[model samples]
Target: MKTLYETSLKESLAIQKRVIGALLMREIITRYGRNNLGFLWLFVEPLMLTLLIVFLWKFLRADRISSLNIVAFILTGYPMAMMWRNASNRAIGAISANVSLLYHRNVRVLDTIISRTLLEVAGATIAQIAIMAVLIAIRWVDVPNDIFYMLLAWLLMALFAFGLGLIICSIAFKFDAFGKIWSTLSFILLPLSGAFFFVSSLPIQAQKYVLWIPMIHGTEMFRHGYFGSSVITMENPWYLLLCDLVLLFVGLAMVAGFSKGVEAR
Candidate 1:
């Protein structure tokens, strides 16, 4: 009897793995099928955007860029924010994009959403790493003293991104125009993300305000790793960690609340 139960359990595990694997492969291939560059564009999109910003800013600042020497600041800030943006935004449309696939008994909602998230996250991380490498090689940016903290910082960023993604994915299922709302809100939120400038560069009160935004903390933490200096004066590692946890739970709650209805659809 125990052997039979064990066999059953193994079969179930194998089934789940097969489902997830198929979904992951389908999601990746589906993305690349549209374009010749395929996966290359994933890296190119963010890389070009970051480089364009750097070039324009450098030009606009002219000699002043070297004075402040904030290339590392931009590199750190932009990629961290972009990671969250890409992951969550892709997630927002994940259900809508792949709703047909959900009809297949083997293609579970979790598998579908996760496949999308993994593609976006993989693309975002690679883009960030490539840009950082180029900047460092060109002497346009400085290196981080602590690899461990940078990894921790990045891991936290991914958690926050995934949390936000889950929440958005939940909403995208039930609402008709959630995508539009998400886009508009993100436009408004971009200025506050601290991507273009350091939080410390803001006025004292503004500094306090920006620190309250959890996304800003991710940037600050990553910048700290890179520069060996803190970006925001109000550095609370614990607070940031707490914020990530809250967002993640909130996301999970939203998913749990809406998952039944979603499956019903």
Candidate 2:
């Protein structure tokens, strides 16, 4: 009986892997189209945006926002911020848009959300790496001082984005109005994410309040990893981790409940 149970579990896992792969391919084709840049757009799109931002900053001759490398600073910060925003935004109508897929016994609503979120996160990550490599090659930026910590912060940022995506996607599925509401909220979240400034640069009183934002911590940590002691930032990895856990728990619960309702219909 135990052997049979194990076999069934393995089969289920294999089937989920296949489902996710197929969905990813379908998403690429649908979103990017079959011709003209194709999958290259995944990285190129964000790369173009980042380059534009970097150019604007340089053109303005904006004095160092902090004691960090300007090119490296924006490169790390903006891409991470964009990743979270894009992931959550893409997840908004994921389940609703793919409702037909749920008719299959193996395809679940959560799978749709996961596949979409993964695509956004993967695209943003690749773009970030590509941009950084070019900047380093051109001597515009130096290699990260602590690559591992930089990666850990990035992972946390992705986790926060995925959790938020699950929550937003579930809520949007339940209420049409949520889509509009979240659109406005995403704008509000932009400056608050600490993508353009260091948390330590804020007034002491404001610093306390800003620390409440989880994305701020992730960005600060990423900067800290790259800039080392050259810049000061307020980052608490433990707090960020705790918030991510809570968000994930609530998000998954909401999504699972919503999925059951969709299945019943």
Candidate 3:
């Protein structure tokens, strides 16, 4: 016979899964209506952006600037950065966008943010995989040297992105103006994420400072997995993991506090 606590835990898990599933479907429809291509745009949007960047870089003689394979470099770094950026960006207005749904007993603030973050992360992941596969088939990019390491980096970045979304969403909820400008701020900071350049490419002094930013570690780790011994990289996965834990702790606390004050409009 199951204890009351066990029964409650199972019921709660079931409810949360059902709520998240429904929210995921709602987001797909809301963001991309029943029009042409609809949900396909989820990945297609990021894939197009990545391809454009690749084209421009190749056109601009990026290959001349680095010994590394420019296509693989861009493919590895850009999409990982996009996963976190897009996830955090999408999480900004999640609660307000779905406040009506919160009227339901099972739906809560965290669920709303999680749903949006999951959508954005999934889109970025699919886009990254699709592009990598096509490029590999065309012989434009070599197969990764350490696929498991790359997967680990990708998973850590996803968790980092989700934690970041929670914190930023909580902040934006309090200061509405911050929400409006976060996109611009994040764009300006994108280059510092080590997506466009490798840590080894930077000066010795700059590398130390750059490592302080957690996103760069994820990017560097990912590139290390792809490029292998072909390049030098400085990525400490443990540091990124510590940062993730701290962010998740702070972000969840802030959300729990602020969420109580939130009222359906």
Candidate 4:
């Protein structure tokens, strides 16, 4: 009995993995199409946005903020923010758009959200590396001082984004109104994400409140990794991780319940 149960579980896991892969491929083809830049736009879209922001900042604020490298500063923060925002936005109504896929027993609601979030994360990561490589080669920015720490912070941010995306996707599935409301709120939230400024630079009282935002911790920690001892980072990785885990758990439970409810109908 135990052996049979183990075999069944393994088979189920494998099938789910295949379903996710298929969904990923379908998303790429459907969204990007088969020709004329096609999938390359994934990285290019974010790359272009980051470069535009970098240039705008360099032209507007030529003086470095708090002795931080302007190019490196924007590179670290903007791309990550884009990833978080894009992933969450794309996740809204993801299930409704792919309702046909849900007809397949293996293609769960969470899988749809996961596949889209992964695409956004992967594209943003590649675009970040490409941007950094080009800037470093041109002597516009130095390589990160603590690469591992930078990556850790970035990973935490990505996980946080994924959790938030999952939760938003689940909510949007049930309530169409949520999609529009979230779009407006996300724009308002972007400036508060610590992408363009350091948390320590804020007034002491403001800093205390801003630090409550998990993305701020991730962004500050990422900047610290790049600036080394020169920057003051008010980040607690454990706190960010805990928040992300809670969001992820709740998101998954909500998605599962929703999927079951839909299947029943």
User: For each candidate, what is the lDDT?
Assistant: 0.74, 0.86, 0.88, 0.84
**Root mean square deviation (Cα) for candidate 4:** 2.5
Better of 1 and 4 by lDDT: 4
**Residue-by-residue lDDT tens digits, candidate 4, 2-22:** 798899999999998899899
Model 2, global lDDT: 0.86
Model 2 shows how many backbone clashes?
0
Q: What local lDDT score does residue 251 receive in model 3, on the 0 to 100 scale?
A: 92
Two-way lDDT contest, 1 vs 3, winner = 3
- Model 3 ranges with Cα > 4 A deviation: 37-65
By TM-score, the candidates rank as 3, 2, 4, 1
Q: For candidate 1, lDDT tens digit of each residue in 10-123?
A: 988998888777777777777777866977876676667767776887778764635645666666777777777878788876766677777777666666667777777777
Give the distance in Å from residue 247's predicted Cα in candidate 1 to where it truly belongs.
1.9
- Point out where model 4 deviates above 4 Å: 1-6, 34-41, 44-61, 64-67, 263-265
Better of 2 and 3 by lDDT: 3
- Residue pairs that clash (backbone atoms under 3 angstroms), model 2: none
**Compared with the true structure, what per-residue lDDT tens digits does model 3 show for residues 1-265?**
9999999999999999999999999998888776758667655765676678778877987768766776787788878887888898999989989998878878899999999999988888887888889889999899999999999999999999999999999999999999979999988878889988889888898889999999999999999899898888999999999999999999999999999877766
Residue pair clashes in candidate 3: none
Estimate TM-scores for all models: 0.85, 0.92, 0.94, 0.90
Give model 3's TM-score versus the native structure.
0.94
